[model samples]
Target: MPHLVLLYTPDLETDADIPSLCRALADTMLEQRDQAGKAVFPTGGTRVLAYPAAHCAVADGKGPYGFLYANLRMGSGRSEQVHKAVGDSLLQVLKRHLDALLQQRPIGITVQIDESQAQVYDAKHSSLHPLFNRPA
Candidate 1:
């Protein structure tokens, strides 16, 4: 179970880039696995999921802005450093990608990590997810 969940608003240009970002995240997980000696994934590899139903509040009464939600899961073995590293890597990549998409438009990016060992909850209901789902 990848403990990290990286969320972001969809790029104004294209939302298809999310899959590529997910791939990069998976690569990072593998690198981290090699360095940390703990499987980032309990199974063969990490499970990366994407959501196209993101809504961010917009300026007028118009509504939420378009966004893409990328959920990448890698078993972290409950390591705090791993959690931090995951956030760091995801943010770095997301920042670069979002910057290109924003094109100087006002935007915000955020990453959330779940380190709890009890159980994995739905990302929709997850506290971390909503925090990043703020108005634009």
Candidate 2:
């Protein structure tokens, strides 16, 4: 699984365009693969979500500052290049999408990519894939 969680300040809600940002990040990971050209993260397994923080404290005091922190969690057995590509791709999307808001207010953006062991990862699901399948 490739899960991207974006934690952004509520002040950005007006201009952050969170939905589009999430889609961009998810598309990047779903379309790209590892150095060996293996699609470890399936399209259905790619997830990108956003959370707007109502209360936040930034380095530039508590006025009009904002922050966007992203965490990308993936299963183990991925190449370092893959991790770097995913994180960098998402980070680029965040910066590019929020460029105007960032220029207006001091905003700090960061992204972290982490891996969890396959043994520790637990998954349970039903046969609902067909419902989400797209028509050709």
Candidate 3:
């Protein structure tokens, strides 16, 4: 299970095409492969969501600066290398997508990956996965 959530200031909404970013991130997740060349994230299990904070304050609360924070959560089974690779790829995409906006405004972008530990409780109920599992 891999879910990417993006939280950003409402001020950036006009310049940030969040829906487009979500599509890009979801596509990137589906492209990741393990060492065996198997998909790192199931096609039907990948999710990218973005939410704009209705009210917030940037650093020092003195400027028109904005911020975007990306957090990716996934089950723990992959090696550190895989995690790093995935994080790097995502950061690159985010940076590339916001390059133009960054040049025009003062904004902070952060990306982080979180892995659920073995002992953590997890549950899932979905009819979507079966659609992707159909026989080819």
Candidate 4:
């Protein structure tokens, strides 16, 4: 099975606690599984990891999106549809917690799905990380 890793910029919480975020991601992935007939790439049996960004701040922009940066990876190349789906799912979760986070800061989300076939050195990894060393 292919592995996917997700990374989000800016710490999830003011205090830097991501328990709730992680739980929500896990739930979202599982929920999408049965909601759709086919499995959702990356999100399907995918694992998420979130951490506090060393540099966390919202950019001056106009929109309902925040200046957030997210990264996603899959063994297969990422498609526009896939990015939209994953981004939508993540936006939903962020919206749910918008009250506590800067939800409308023109979030800069970047998702990169792998194109090369599965490799032997490709070990499974999580998306969330401290900052620089997260998913691709």
Candidate 5:
């Protein structure tokens, strides 16, 4: 249920490659499972996407600015520490992915991990969950 959506300014398109970033994020979640001993997300259920806004304004309306905003939405069952772990791990990936952009210019990256309310949230999954659980 961990779905990450990335929104960036137009100029950062070069640094924010959607397909590659998505795979990286999915791998990061899998790494959490390997390290923390928990299924952070289903392999087939991980959804990481990127969207470049048509119009964006940051700081001031002076020069071209780049911004990377990642929002992670998941089911509500984890502790604050777990949330921090996810956020930190995700931030590391985003930082590394956008390192060159940041080094060459002034860019901002933010990662926000949020939980969905169990009462209102609804989901539909498939047999892919079992596929992911199969022995490697």
Candidate 6:
């Protein structure tokens, strides 16, 4: 499972085109492959969600400064190289997506991937996975 949660300043919502970013990110996740060339994240388990903060205060509470924080959480098993590759790919997309808004205003973007350890109790119940399991 790989879920990307984006938290951004409310002011950027109008110009952020967040829905597009979510689609791009989901596609990027589906594109990731392991050393064996198998999909790293299940198509049905991939999710990208964005939430605009109701109230945000930029540095010194000065001019309008926007911020986008992306956190990707996935089940652990991949190698360090795979993790880095995934993170890099995501960061590049995030930067490219917000480049235009960055030039127009002061915005900070941060992207990070978190691997859920074995100790973490996780549970899932969904019919979506079967849809992706059908023969091509």
lDDT of 4: 0.51
Expressed as tens digits, the lDDT of each residue in 1-136 for candidate 3 is 7999999999878887888989999999999988889889999989998999988988898877989999999988898878988999999998899999889878898999998886556788999999999999
Candidate 6 off by > 4 Å:
118-120
| Model 1 pairs in collision | 1-74, 1-75, 2-74, 2-75, 10-67, 10-68, 40-75, 56-64
Estimate, for each residue in 12-117, the C-alpha lDDT of model 1 and write its tens digit: 4364377777677666665665354765553333456654436545445353344433444443365677667767877787777666555645555556665445
* Candidate 6 C-alpha lDDT tens digits along 1-136: 7899999999878987889999999999999998989999999999999999988887887787899999999888899989999999999999999998888878998888888886557788999999999999
Model 3 CA deviation exceeding 4 Å by range: 118-120
Candidate 1 regions with alpha-carbon error over 4 angstroms: 3-16, 34-39, 54-77, 120-136
The positional error of residue 104 in candidate 5, measured at the CA in angstroms, is 1.2
Q: Which digits, one per residue and each the tens of the lDDT, describe model 2 over residues 1-136? A: 6788988878778777888888888878877777778775777777888999877778858578888899988888888888777777777888888888877878889999888864654875835455556686
Among these predictions, the greatest lDDT belongs to 6
Model with the higher lDDT, candidate 2 or 3: 3
Off by over 4 Å in 2: 60-62, 118-121, 126-136
Cα-based lDDT for every prediction: 0.55, 0.80, 0.90, 0.51, 0.80, 0.91
List, in order, the clash count of every candidate structure. Answer: 8, 0, 0, 10, 0, 0
**Residue 135 in candidate 6 has what lDDT?**
100
Indicate the TM-score of model 1: 0.60
What would you estimate as the lDDT of candidate 1? Answer: 0.55
Tens-place lDDT per residue, model 4, 1-136, is 2333444544434532456766775666545432335555434345666645565445543334333344445455545575566657866775565445553343454444445656668554544433534468
Rank list by TM-score: 6, 3, 5, 2, 1, 4
Reference-based TM-score of each model? 0.60, 0.85, 0.94, 0.51, 0.86, 0.95
